[model samples]
Target chain A: MSNKLLECVPNFSEGRNKEVIERIVDPFRKTEGVKLLDYSADKDHNRLVVTVIGDPEGLKKSVLEAMAVAVKEIDMNNHKGEHPRMGAVDVVPFIPVRNVTMEEAVELAKEVARQAAEKFNLPVYLYEDAATSPDRQNLASIRKGQFEGFKEKIKKPEWKPDFGPAEVHPTAGVTAVGARMPLVAFNVNLGTDNIEIADAIARKVRYIGGGLRYCKAIGVDLKERGIVQISMNMTNYTKTSLYQAYELIKVEARRYGVNVVGSELIGILPAQALIDVAVYYLGVENFSEEQILENRLLWG
Target chain B: MSNKLLECVPNFSEGRNKEVIERIVDPFRKTEGVKLLDYSADKDHNRLVVTVIGDPEGLKKSVLEAMAVAVKEIDMNNHKGEHPRMGAVDVVPFIPVRNVTMEEAVELAKEVARQAAEKFNLPVYLYEDAATSPDRQNLASIRKGQFEGFKEKIKKPEWKPDFGPAEVHPTAGVTAVGARMPLVAFNVNLGTDNIEIADAIARKVRYIGGGLRYCKAIGVDLKERGIVQISMNMTNYTKTSLYQAYELIKVEARRYGVNVVGSELIGILPAQALIDVAVYYLGVENFSEEQILENRLLWG
Candidate 1:
């Protein structure tokens, strides 16, 4: 087997302060095995999302070091953003990229959660695939009242923390560590500026509305461009391919006489996801990732 | 910039002898920074094709070691094969994979060719992009007379070896070394077993027949499977993408009323080649390889 690669997208609560964000991301940059793919700070959301991929052990160590920096430099009590959060180091989701199983990711998540809780005296909750109970599986459920209400909410038996003290950390608050599949942020732009058409199509093409099994979508107005967009989070590309969502959107848009102008991939995504879409569009048979020379060099 | 990567596909004369094939392939397997992507031996063709990619220096060293092994074990005088050949080590093509230009590949090829000829007392002829003259640009032209005729062919001033003695190596014969674009071996199978229909489509989809500029194709009968195939070598995917070839074949097949049953990729191909096909078929706007997570992780 080749190297086990795990993608970790860690969100932090202090995006407005450049120094704090840089400090928190330092370990990831310096870590030997860890590759820092991308990092961005949203001023409106006041959140920093850092994308990284590396071996489980190296990733665990690097995340721990970054978490320590976050605990030291960020104060969640003073944090304010458009996005919801419950801690200085808000959430860390481990995604299995290559040569790694979901079970292994869950195990790694729990291990990192335990280490962080013990090392920093900070409260940690296991969510998503690493959740101890079904009720905690959804991240929003655990972060219901955000940082302010977490202190009181954590004391409840049903809402007890997975690790460390039940009470929230005085300044850092609490963090959620979990394992999940890679999420693809895909968006389709329609020729018409009518937001209603995009909204109608998005409703019929998402999982919540009985469409694709693992797709979550919302319609947004691209005011500057005079067009509407069907933004989507493809939670599981294996079950709900990019092409399926694209074709569905095209079909639905045609109902309202709207043509798809183009599409956008918001961030980094697994190469296999796009390869699958290529196979579908090209009607290729017996296609394998091994046939791609670069993948073979990296994985072989 | 990331490390420069070059792909080398070397064809050896002895494929029937497992021991000799293994000996020739061992250096590539053990060399550092040189990844042995694939190695296959065809009994009928009596040839061994080894695909590898790595840093220039490391790859050159490994190739030389393998060539030495091939020179010692394989004798062209006693060689018998269905595939055309003129040496123990028939041909070595250097392809620029990533961060490496064609000029650099040509230089590397010339360097390796000179080294091999000097060290082995073997005659080496540069072909393809590294050809000393336009007449030697095609491997088939340089290998016209085969091993037995090379002794006299080399005597001609126009056919003098690029390096070493003008005469062939009595036992090993002459080797061809050069640089060229990555060659993609793509085959599209048709539903019907009508070789004429396949041949007609192949003629209309190949460069020689005024079809795609970078394509070379021929019709082949898959007798056992009861189908005819258009076997192709896409010499430059950047200029003539896989989709362009596939689409052209589809258009030509329509003339003969034959349906495409399936397609096959014979060996490893650059990921960019497939990505181009996906972008064209999906009609995606502003798609960049940086958006692919694995590419970013590996090359960013």
Candidate 2:
């Protein structure tokens, strides 16, 4: 468990130009001790998302090198995007993946934030686990005023940047960096077209509605499929297993005389999350991670 | 999917002597491209079990090296164990863990069997998937005659080995080499202590009893816990999942008003077996091995 792994997902403003995107991603590829897991761009959002995992120092080094490219290549004033943006290198999140701790991740985020603000003269706000106050914990709140609105918003007394000068950069604008747990995007489709059932179950299973502590749920209507989905963000799957939420939804659906058609897991998730569900369903006792053959290949 | 990985488990005769056990295990450690996953010696059984995984050629080379050490250190003429044995190295099974096919594993098994028999001057029988006939398919049937009994048994026309001489070695007896699918040691325990319910369900659920295609089940009485268990070996988990067998047992138990009191997974199993169970219970569609973070670290 002392292997020390962290995932860094940094989003940049430019997405259409392949050369610029490659230029910004080249450092991550060239950096030692860092593996570029994936990278994708959306022309409409005009955003490029790069995912990489490595040791703390290595990840920090790569992100800084990549940030330099974004700063030199992108100017927020000339940027146009369908998605909200506040800076050339919009946001970066450091996730504690394996042996790394949240506190350590928070420290790593702060170090990157301070170094980035100093190097690029870009205002940085710490959000989520790395936030200085509760108000800064939500990334959306800090990024509420997009690139244009952030120019005037940065001057407010309570809206001061956590790192660098109070003023936004002349071109790059501002950015947000944070440390947070891995999120599991899970959706359970009910065998009915009643969106209200999905809505009610979503509210019942979400954290605010007194369900799982680390869950955030919403209802989605899959019009073409003729079914409703209870979408969820399992913020901490270790504490709140995906199966627990699925079973709870199934129980709730039974009351409404509906069956669960199927479920979907969006994006990526830690292998342990899936293993936990396997152990639960199979009722496996005395099972260890070492029992999993891939664990040896991954760690040893 | 093209990445070839196979598991080789070789059982040796000498377990009481620490020096001999270490000597037999040394080659697997020193060999490149091979990982010595586990090795345990049971003094009562006077047997040494070694588990290793690697590319086909690497695994074959390591096993042959270890077999030489085992053959040199232990004399079958003086060997005795609670478990049945007919050679210094009793049996070797080649299991396709990932990407590797059963046909490829069988070829590897045959190559090892021919080489081991020629070098060591020991008789080797093909068993399981590599069996030349249905009678030689079971390791037990081939090894039914113990070392003392095997001397005379080997000269019989029907008992001739697929490799090496028809007669046994002066010190090292005959051996069995096999290629088989990954087997799952799964047990589903019931709330009742009555052995009949467990036995009846076991009969209804096993392949021989018109149930799952690849299941072998038996009922065990747990006097201490006041429960019964349906112990099973899912010989081919791909065709017959652990969940399917467990669910069927639950349905059968319900007829007798018995409840399932959890279950136990014995020894090591391939990770795909666990993932298959997760996919079944969670109803997760479109989930790929690539989505598991460890898979990126493992194959990437």
Candidate 3:
């Protein structure tokens, strides 16, 4: 609660079983200092994503506790799911929320990795900011073989785990721990149901399409709502803001004789991203986040 | 900070002396749970306003400590200022910011008032929501005739102090303590420099002229910026939001062909006020404040 905030989103393998999910999520709910922001279990993906925020000490403790439950409940040998995951506790990413620096978050992730490997005898990959090597930085590259293929892939000289034995565990499998910036799930809905308008805007507003450098967007048709939405993941809000993508979509839609009906923020987002919108739209000059009342309390 | 949040803005007389001002504000900064959100001194008005937020216990302790300092340093008999005053420590307002209700805030104000009356032997009047009588609810009515007049005014039956001795303190004078909703100091700058357009729009957008219920607006000329401004105090953002005021001002400005050049928020404001702007402009339906990352932590 006293500044130095860190956000941990740990993805566990068990999602379908009601009792198992509860057991895995118990530590996060019961932890004193940790604030469980969100937790969801998708039956189709058979994956659980738990979002929690707290100081370094409390967050790390809660994460390891949840990891232990996931290890005990999920047996990778018999586990089957559509999502590509390499372990029972698939990916644990520590994001710097407030006063915490990315380097500090990386150190925290490494600490968790070091602890998990010894306590559970599970192979851990330090991906992203905590990655030992350049190739290990991408979670997908490290998780290329999945749990089954990783059993043999671990024997490769280049594919050695960062912690624990050079071999995979019997039940728990492998997990990725790292640090990364906060991602914003922002979507802009178009006036017309025609998805073509959405696709056109998405191309003009995404990184690969030579638009905003930090955006990854795709057109989605909300069939029930009778609109087309440019569902987006703002990978780096600081670099390419929500307003940047939103305004571009508005501009692109105008060419097609379409209006942006509305926009949506799908999941949780950092408060600064939202405040930036107000500052931009209102043309409030030299406005600092310090002026936000709640922020002063949390800044600690 | 754990859900039961309260905002206290304590205004004290004597703004010219920086040494005395710091002494008054030091307790709020030193207290553990209390957060010093903002503090400003107006030389002309000769007043010091300190905005702090904390839990009930911590907030109460800081306010009382500051009151003692004001009592020791300031003597109303020799005090002279342009602004209205009835005490060394003039007014203390408790506001519900996050999860705390208005009723709970009123209770907190009462506790502070009772303690101030006992410790400092100062006459205390509860205004706004904490007022025992309807007449006392309005601070101005209770503060009639200023410090020089309140001595004789207190002899009347209707003017009996809510707490403390029936008479005011020999040096400290009398103060008002109460609870109320958070106010937003919002100002919209017009493209034109003409003061008439700003005045006309202000009349159309304020409550007295049949506009938004919770808005009080005035026209101002920002000579340095060469723009006329519609300065406003949105007394209740929940009922009359920033976007509502901004949008209405835009619509009204159309008649005079003056674009809203910019807007500014003076001092501190609740985070929800800014979030509400994004929700309205973006057309985000069914969005909850709980979804804000920083808020999730502060919600406790």
Candidate 4:
């Protein structure tokens, strides 16, 4: 069997203060098993995004250490950010990397939530695939009122925290822990400057409007570039690959005689996604990732 | 910087004797740094192929251990095979995997060749990318004949062994050592049963016939299946991506109204190859392997 691998992307609400951000991320750097691939801080958004990969046990340990620092150093009452926030530590989503089932990832989420609640006396809400109730499955549903509104909402029956006391923490606020698929930010630009046509195509291709499944699409006018775009977030590529989404948008945009200018993948993507597109576009038969020499060189 | 990685494929002359083959391969299995990825024995060809990947040092140690075993157990005079043979331990080709330059690989080949000649008293010839002489750069030129023909060929000034005595070893015989790029066996089957069309298309696509550079193409008739194929081996994928080759063949085959049934990659390929194809086919702008979540996870 292949080796076990998992990805963890954690968001923190103290990006403006460099010392605080580094202090909070210090534990991850010191951790043995987990590797800290990258971390970025945005002053405007007042948020820090950290990317990590490691064995499940090691990742859990590192997250706990980092959270302890966050709880000790960050106070929600003094925090202000453009982005939505409910805790100093904010949101943490665990993604299965290799040889790990989504079910196992959910279990890991629960384990992390339970430990955080017991260790720091903080409230934790399970969202997405780890949700105990159907309503909490969507993170927005759990974070409905943001921090201020959630303070009052927590006292209600449905708004109770999944792993802590119904009462919100004194200053650390609340955290949402979940297991979910990686989200790929993909965008396709049209050669024409027809904003209405781009909007129509985006609406036609998005999931809510009966387009591709697992795709959330929206049209935005690239005013500076004199073009239109179909911005999309592929929440689950396994169900609807990049090629499917691109082709759909291409065909849909062509209805108005608009030609595709180009496409951009906002962030990192899985190797399998690229392979899937290659097979479809190149008409390659019986191609496998194992057929990739570099991949084989990675392991016996 | 990342650790330097290399792939080595060693060919042995004794495939019929399972016990002898196992004994010869034991060193590779036990070596610390070297990873023995695969080994295959062909009775008809009477050859054993062992695939390994590792650091330069790891490969050197493993090769020596395996050579010692081969020297003790096999004799070239008694050897019989459908494939060419000059030694019990026939040929070893080192391929740079990652972060290792071709020059470094050539130096490694020379060191291994010198060690083999000095330690085992086996004559050695360098070929392919590591050849010292322009004429010896090709394997066929160095291996002019099977073991029997090579005995006489070795005495000639032009055909003298690069290392060890002018005479071949009494039992173990001579071994060829060199550094070369990985060869990808790529075959494309035509949807129609037109042998003449396949042959003409193959002629138009191969390097010798002015098709794609770094590509060797031949047309074969799959008589039983009643389909013709354009069989090719891509020596350098960086210069020619899989999709580029497939696209050209598709275009040429179209001249005769031949539809491409499918393409086959005979062995392992580098991840970059597939990534390139995906980028071309999907029109993915500025795509990178690091964007793959799985690849990022592996790095971390």
Candidate 5:
């Protein structure tokens, strides 16, 4: 692990257009030192999310280049999506991957936000760990009414932009830049097709409803698979491990006589999270990362 | 993620002499492109094992340079150790770490063996997947009576050197070079200190006694800890996962009402092995290596 490594997940407003989405993510591939881990465009939400990992210096340069492309190609005023949005390059969150701390990631986010706000004259709101105000800690609060409604909402003394002018950019819109922990999108499917059961279980497991501290969950009907799923976004795996959340769900579902048929980790996850699950389930008393041969090879 | 990565574990005959062991292992660290993953000198065994991983070309050069040092610094004729041995530069195994195949690793082993034999005139024996004869496939069989007895044993046609003259080097002695799958040193300690019960369980679970294939296990007393351990060497983890072995041992130990205290992975292991354990334990229905964030980050 290198102390300089950082993880960045940037959201873009236009996900429906394949060409435009590729163009926006092209900078991550073209840029040196940055590793483009994953990128996906959701058609229904009309949103694109790109996952990138690299050194702080390299990632800062890559995000600027990506923003330059997104600003020119995307017209946020015409953007129509089910998901919330504030800019063409909607939200950029810097995450400390390894050998780096949250505080350092916050500093990196501020540096990136400063550059984007100054160079493009676009308003930037720091959310989560990089928030300038306590009200900015939650992204929903920062982007309460999306771009159109929030455009006028800015100019208020409490809603002034963290960077850029009080006015929102007409076409490009304002962007949210912040630091956050790595988020793991995990879901478990039950044997029964009862969507109600899944919903009740989700309510009991989500943080908003006094469940797992770092989890936000919802139950969805998987029509094609003929099952219901408790889709969850584990915002912080270290605080609430996959095993702890999964066993809780399993135990909760069993009360309704529902058997967990399967589970899915939708996106990239940290190696330690998986190791934690392994150690828990296998009863591997004192297994360390060095016990993993591939890890040893990488360290070597 | 590199296409040409290779891992080499070289064992030398001098562990007691810190200076001699250091001199023998220094070339691996000094060599360009080669990463010295780890090295250990065991006084009880009087042997040094140096682990190196890197580009194939650089690894081969480094191994040869290290062997030159071993040949000049150590003499096997007067060598004394608790562990079995055959030469100053005893055994060198080329392991395919990533983006490499067993056949390619075999080719590499043969090439290194040829160079060692031609340069140092030390007789070489190929074992494991690189063995020419079925009898030679087992390294213990190749080193049957160790260095002292093997000198006279080499006179037979069945013990002919794979790459050198029929005779062993006068001072450095003979060497064994081969290609092998990564071996995981996994052990499960029992809460009780009954060596007899542990031995009985080991026999029932070891491959030779019709247990798991690709698994070699034995029972030993952890005297200082007051526990009996089922020490295991998983020769091929892809075939027999770590959880499978641990589960079997748990079942076998339960007959005598013994519980598992802890387990340990003695050295470096492949990341896939840990991933396999994670998938098994987490009940992750459909997981891919891409789901591991660190793996994806390393891909670039």
Candidate 6:
């Protein structure tokens, strides 16, 4: 069998200090069986996001190493960011990319969370598919109180993490580790500059508005381009595809007499996402990923 | 730079004999850096088609080994098959799958052809992008006389073999070796079984009929299913994408009051072919293959 590939995206609290960000991400570089696809630090959010993929064992080892570095360098007491956070090494989500099942991914995430908690003496909360309780399934719920408020909130019986002590660590507050489906950040730009039109369409097509499930959307202003954009996070492309979101946006925009200028994918996505759309548009029957020559060789 | 991937599909004349087929395909198995994607034999055609992909050097070495096995075991003088053939190890076409340019693939093909000719003392003809002359560019023209007639046909000045002596091998005959773009065997099934409608649409959409430049299409009857198919060999997907053919077929079928039931890809195709169609249908303004996380790791 081919190696099981798992994608890990870990968010660190220190994004302003370039040296600290590099130190946290350094472990993923030049590691055997581990490929560091991308890492970016946002000053405004004061957070660093690192993306890496590889064999399950190799990836777990590299991510642990990076976590150790983050624990040593970052202190949540002094952390300040626009994005919500409950720890120095904030959230680490393990996504199944290829030849891996969700159950296996969940087990891997739990193992990592256990190891991190035991070694670093840092609190680790299991969220998403790997959550210990239904209430903790959402990261926002786990991080409801941010780093400062988490100190008192951790003592609550329901807020107790799946792993680690009831109290937050002195430096690295806490971390959320779990398994989840791959997320696609897709943005659609409208010909008009009216933000209200973009907002209305976002509301009409998003899951919150009883539109498509597995979609989270918001409107943004692209002032320089003189256009309004509906940015979406397609959390589960298998159930709700990119094309589905695009078509819905197009149909919703028609109400306001707005034409879709174009769309863009923000970051990396699994190849299957695009293949699904292609199969739909081309009306191909009985198509398989194995029919892709490159995929065959890669899996082998 | 990453390793350049090249796909080689070689046809051998002895398909009826399982042992001979296995012998010809043995080299591709257990070879480091060389992946044997598929190998199949057709009794009616009396041919074995093997698909392998790897680095240029490794692929060339494996192909030569397979050719030597074919030359020693199969004697084309006594061969009989439905498919046209001029050699024991008939034709080998090198395709650029990733990171390799057409010129590089052509060079690789020539080197392999030269080695095969010198080692086995067999006549080799270069066709497609690696053709030495315009007349030699089409494999059909080189294979016109077949193995039985090649003895006299090869003696002509314009028919001089690109490699080895002008005379064909007593047992193996001649081989056609060259580079070409990946071919997608896409078949579109029509709602109706009217063979004439399928034939007219094929003629209207194929290159010979002043339709798409890179498409070669023919009509086929699927008797058991009670449907007609527009069988096509999309020679260059980069120039004429799968969607272009699919949409054109949909439009053409409408004129005949027939709707397309479904389409199928006969064999392995490059992932780019499907991705291109998805990008077109999605109206993605700036999409890159690198954005595919699995592809990034595979290519790296």
Best by DockQ: 6
DockQ of each: 0.69, 0.73, 0.61, 0.61, 0.63, 0.76
Each predicted model: what fraction of the native A–B Cα contacts (within 8 Å) does it retain? 0.75, 0.77, 0.68, 0.76, 0.77, 0.82
- Give stretches of model 5 more than 4 Å off: A16-23, A290-300
Worst 10 residues of 5 chain B by lDDT: B291-300
Comparing 5 with 6 on TM-score, the higher-scoring candidate is: 6
State each model's CA lDDT, in order.
Answer: 0.91, 0.90, 0.89, 0.84, 0.87, 0.91
Q: Chain A vs. true chain A, TM-score per candidate? A: 0.96, 0.96, 0.91, 0.95, 0.93, 0.95
Every model's TM-score on chain B: 0.95, 0.95, 0.92, 0.94, 0.96, 0.97
**Clash count per candidate:** 0, 0, 0, 7, 6, 0
Question: Model 4 chain B, poorest ten-residue lDDT window?
Answer: B291-300
Better of 1 and 5 by lDDT: 1
lDDT of 1 by residue, A11-84 (tens): 99888889888888899999988988889999999999999999998899999999999988888878899999
Model 1: DockQ score: 0.69
lDDT for position A186 in model 6: 91
Candidate 5 per-residue lDDT, tens place, B1-300, comes to: 246787899999999998888788888888887888889999889999998888788888999999999999898888999999999999999998778899999999999999999998889999999999999999899987888887799999999999999987888888999999889888888998899988988898889988999889999999999999999999999898989889998899889999988787777776778778878866777688878776775554
Clash pairs, model 1 backbone: none
Candidate 3: tens digits of C-alpha lDDT, residues A1-300: 556788889999887999999988888888877888889999878899999888898888889998998988899998888999899999999999877888999999999999999999998999988899999988899999899999899999899899999888899899999998998999888889998888888988899899999898999999999999999999888878778888888889889999888888878888888888877777787787888877776773
Could you give candidate 4's per-residue lDDT for residues A1-300 as a string of tens digits?
Answer: 236667788898888999989987887788877778789999988889998877788889999988898888888888898998898878989998767889988998999999999899989999889999999988887877777777799999888888988877878889999999878888898998988888898888888899988998888899999998999989888788989988998888768888888888877767777777777776677776777654665443
Model 3 regions lying over 4 Å from their true place: A17-23, A26-34, A57-65, A114-121, A130-138, A141-145, A151-168, B16-36, B41-44, B57-65, B107-124, B131-144, B149-170
Lowest-sum lDDT 10-residue window in model 6 chain A:
A291-300
Q: What's the TM-score, to 2 decimals, of chain B in model 6?
A: 0.97
| Residues B64-120 of candidate 1: C-alpha lDDT, one tens digit per residue | 999999999998989988999999999999999888999999999999999999999
TM-score for each model: 0.95, 0.96, 0.88, 0.95, 0.95, 0.96
